[model samples]
Target: MEGHACPHEDILETMRKLLVAAALAGCALSPLTAYADAPGQSPAEKADPAAREISADQIEATVQFLADDLLQGRDTGSEYYDIAAAYVASRYRAMGLTPGVDGKWMQDITFRKASPAESTLAIVQDGKAKELELKTDFITGASFTDQLIDMSAPMVFVGQGIHSPENGIDDYAGLDVKGKVVVVVSGAPKGVPGDVAATLSRGKTKVASDMGAVGMISIRSKSAMESLPFEKLVGYIEGHAEKWVAPDGTVVVDAPNLKFSTYLSPEAAADLVDSSGHDLSALLDAYESEEEDAVRPTGFVIPGEVKVKAVSEWEEVTSANVVAVLPGSDPQLADQYVVMSAHLDHVGNHLWEAGEDEDGEPKDTIYNGALDNAAGVATMLEVARVIAENPTAPRRPILFVALTGEEKGLLGSEYMAKYWVREDGEPVGVVNFDMPVLLYDMDDVVGFGAENSTMGETLAAAGAATGIGVTPDFLPDENLFVRSDHYSFVKEGVPALFLMSGVENGGKEAFTNFLKTDYHGPGDDLSQPLNWESARKFALLNYEIVKLTANADARPMWYEGNYFGDKFDPEGPRAPAPAEAAE
Candidate 1:
């Protein structure tokens, strides 16, 4: 303690420091002290729940049935999807768990599908207005904004929309974005991880709003178009019905600050940039041209207001979120709830099978998202069952949620995070299970958002219980943190973690291959190789985490200087960690 100074060193780092002292004292390293969670130790041992109640057979059976093609990929708006919900509800009723939402197992989530009836992007050239075609030139969208958006704001193009001071990069440097609409590309620099870059892109909206900007315009650059083919990109955003989150229903707080936002086509973006005397192609080339300078400041400032008007038509539809509760045993701790969540929806069936394989056979049309989420849901059900069936309940209540419309941009989880409240009403933490591809044995788990709070420690302890290790996010650039249900909770000022079967033990290869060979395709069915034993371990690990977070005498707190906590929960970093935890 006298020699160490850093308070944030992990267990291994602390050990390394200790080793230095041991050599000074001329002592051999004690094996007992070497292990963080020894076989038998006070406060450092595994709180392994009797996981005998968790059955591998049941897990496999549940996964097989849910991911089966007969369910028609369990699309969110289809009858098959409703059938899946009913099945989950039935299981909740049978498990003796109480309804989490009011007095019912279902939390009715209403969604408004918005489609642009008419969209126009016009510019005042020499005080004369010119209109740009809707789909051909640009695709203006406002699923959350009013049915109509009319704005004549100035424009600024930010590279990757990054503004991290630590990274020595600021796309909006030396510019004022107040009362302006900032245009940005759809991606980050090449070296930046997709998750981190995407997260930076998300922060760009907030940065602009804080800077007093009115709106945003995202133009898919040439690099973006090449990275994701034009046809595939258009197909994704071309759907008439975009799941629109209500102002009060969304986890994205910055979306409301924007008056209008749209995606401009390459030709359309070129037209806008030409007025600034900068070639759109040259700007894109700058991003790819220099490796060290992943992104360079596009110093071109285009003058004049480009009026954006979007008129949309919407239809309301309803979906159900299956929620159940295992009431805590301890009265004091029962007030706080630990939520365990997983999405129940998938991409559903393909419109039609157009692609062909090497053998000239038609590609599988139905998107049986076995690993994408059905596996996650099945594991959630198993964890719930095991915990509820236990003789002794945890001190804090455990809320289990099977969300809807996750494929539609995490709609249900965002809805619940905004509306759902614990019976006694105290925030604790969240654990989200998304796609846990268990093709082989996994010794570690990658937590997407665990660094924000004590959820990181909880995951470590839970991993120790099952001889599994916890690793930091390896794909931070993918923006994996905000891509799932847990992020919805995070935005509401809750510390949360998104767990995935890690990329250890050839998991890198296994997971990568699974993505290429099966992900969202019909191949994500029963025929896909799944490790039932791995699934069992994962469920057990989930159980241990629930017990750890729910039964601990103390509430989970945000770690000091967590990047996410500082942004979402401002007051969190102000609190000091325990002195004993310091180096």
Candidate 2:
């Protein structure tokens, strides 16, 4: 048996081998050899009764329907998404599953989509306004909010707009940005931890907003532009920008207080800062150059104010987190909920611009999100159906949530975790299903963040029950833990498990190709080679884990003083088992 706490790297290597070996031993029809008949395999290994009961046919039906072109990729704030929601809700009713909230399976979420209407901004210097090109010199802004604003505010250069009192760093010190526009370089200086820097940089706008700054313009540091090209950033901002709304009906985002926010192209950023007593190139070198710790505040405000005119319209859009509940058998522990979750939304489709392919045919328009999520949603619906049909209920209620706006920014899960109540009680744990990419009929399952909580033990039990070995995340550098819907539950101090198919047995090549070629693109459709049986087996594995969690003698809890538990809820930690605690 594994301990409650496992070191990430050691356990990752150990489990990788265990997972690949067991998978090769015939965890299913496909192993390392890709659907070959391996020797010394049990009948259960070839075809699981539970998996067979779940039925690949049913899984295919749901995936096909959800990933179809008619749904238009299930974009967050679109009419097509409404139709998809209706379909999921209809399935819940047909299965006789109880609603998770208010006799309605749908939980309303508010969102904001900001688009540039008539965008024009310039630098005011020496009684002459130097106008900037929209996409060339700069790009019109989206994000934070949608509104028309005309402001003549002074530009103050703050290193990265960071003010960390915990660390002895304050770029705002000896600088006043009240009612002014602050120009900041994108990203943080060296020596700051990546996650911490990201947290600070993300919250920088709030600091600026609180400082009474009316607006901000971000210059792409060379490192930033190198990481993500200017053209890609432009594509992001040009689209319909969305963020989740709070109870107050306002967009609940990082930079709510600012009247405007914009990102400047590197060339234009240099042009704007020229001859302003501060050199952009020199400032960038101070931070990113060989002198790692030499970066600090440069108390130089540009000589003149900036003239910005942003024209945009605003509209209130709504989406939902589909919720259904299955009650537990035990009266004492049933109130503690085990959430079976997945995101129902995808990037949807980019608008059909008039264009032609090399063959002189119309280009691909719809983004059919087959593996990106519809698979997970279909898996969720199947689990709900099987549980509802079964007579024996688990000890804890299962909250089946198909979230919206995950592609937009995990907005649906964020709202659900903070607001949704399971029979007026909190969640005991979360099992998130996402991007299964079950293209290879393979061996091994991967669990992200399972080591941080009791979910690790539950995952071991699940693998044992399903005859599939579990491994730690193979790609820890990708930050998979924070990239999905499970993160919201983690932020709330709830223990979580994010199940993924491992990349072994040629699965790595398949996964890489899928991510590079099909992920978020129109090609992620039914036309792609999908392993329906493997998807069914994945549902079985998830079902086993979630069931173990639901029927556990004690609810799942974060390991003692872990990063998330220590940071988000210092008071909450799962009590160790008597035997384990005595070790």
Candidate 3:
């Protein structure tokens, strides 16, 4: 990564060189013309070809505006986020789509910002007391209440605190934690399949809640605690704003009061656990041993009560999903809908001061998320314009949605999927555009969670049509499938696809390198070289796939055997298909 201290002159010079290179490469590629319907054609046949076309200029324009520093990285709950939202809404209105739900394009979501008002911890060994600083020495909180807890409830250390029926392991089996504070290790028991981390994290919270624990505090592993800081830890907490679901197939409340917290400093944690007579090294060894199915808690039960008073204030801020609709020509077919979406939010400015960049210069720049999502949002807008200009609408309604708060954990999309309903109350099929363009060259398009629905085949056909092959995600073990906005829709039983360019054939090094250095840092910027032409091509291909899915007579179905497929009933009552559902 380049130093952030590049002078203004250097910035200007670099941009000039790139622009000249682009110009030399020949800037005027012919606009992809729409294919005309046959003569004496039915209303469907007379549909505009413009619906499938996207312009390079439009893509550049949207990307430029959204990635501009003035928007301050489009951070959720920041003024910059509002700017991005307003811009998207304006463009949608200009494209001639109706406002969503209440004749307004914006959907308001409420968020709570919370932190501990006061916290105190004590270590008692040999009948002696040692006090710890609240933030520096310990971190704790609960989701169940914002009120102060002033009880010295006994603490029981549970190793990994996992209870997986599928694995035939039950860590909580004979233990009762009712009204007690349970201390658990942060990660899964060692030797568990590497892929089990995600499932464990999701399920562990539920188990803790069901166990009736007053509070759950996860001690970070030694390595994790050494590397992370309170700021980043707190930042992650702020980012976990997604909607959760209960096992019974109900949408749990947005921001449910499930008190879960962690500490990032090893030194702080060592102070809390050292007083126990059991050796820390031995305990960790047992926690990490693969042979131990019955990993016992360290048995260092603390008798002193701890109290936590946390106050979270709700800030009512207005944010929007930029929406534009292309209505179908046939009244009956138009009722069904296909929606395309991308997130426009990113991890904005770093709150703490961290000194200067590499050039010995002061550094306080914002974390501009150019490629992380500005690029994706730009792609969606260009596709919208191209499809709108096309001569005819497809058989079903097409909706273009630019979502907000994705970096804050898919909050925007989750809210829409769980709460937004049509006038007659049916949900729409969502096709999400997330992290699509890659700096590396591609051999195929990778579809995350593609097997969940027949949309995978539609994506394959579109890729084939464009000479871009389709491939299932090569790194399913990473669980990339559930890491994006598409998961929210899939959880709601809405068939969706998350697309990405394939890894360069040379090796996996490129993907890892980019993520390590460029993925979320200041290094991600428009000034960096990007293959815009490939991005434009991707937009065009996506338009075609959406068109096909919308126009198909049979709605896309989830593939059997997939977890999501088995969970949702495709034949169940659907919200009234919007006029655009057919196309």
List the candidates' TM-scores in order: 0.81, 0.82, 0.78
Q: Rank the candidates by TM-score, best first.
A: 2, 1, 3
lDDT of 3 by residue, 52-113 (tens): 34555556656666775556678777888987887778777766677765777777665443
TM-score, prediction 2: 0.82
Task: For residues 1-583, write the lDDT of model 1, one tens digit per residue.
Answer: 2111235556456456434422322221232232343344223233433454555665776676667555678877678888788778877877788988788888887677776677778877678787877767777664554777777987777665667885567777887887788878766666654555666766777776776778877777666687676446556665655453554664244655777677777887888887877777877777766477354855445777789877877776778788899888888776788999999988777756557768976666778788889889988987887677667888888988999999888888887887774547755689888999889987788877665577777888777667778876666635677899988888778888788888788877887788678876777876777998788778778877877888887777876765566667877533354353232
Ten-residue stretch with the least lDDT total in model 2: 23-32
Of 1 and 3, which scores higher on TM-score? 1
Q: Write the per-residue lDDT of candidate 2 for residues 277-305, one digit (tens) a residue.
A: 66789888777764655757565688788
RMSD in angstroms, all models? 13.5, 10.5, 7.5
Arranged by lDDT, best first: 2, 1, 3
Q: Which model, 1 or 2, shows the larger lDDT?
A: 2
Q: What TM-score number comes out for model 3?
A: 0.78
Top-scoring candidate (lDDT): 2
Q: Considering lDDT, which of the candidate structures 1 and 3 is the better prediction for this target?
A: 1
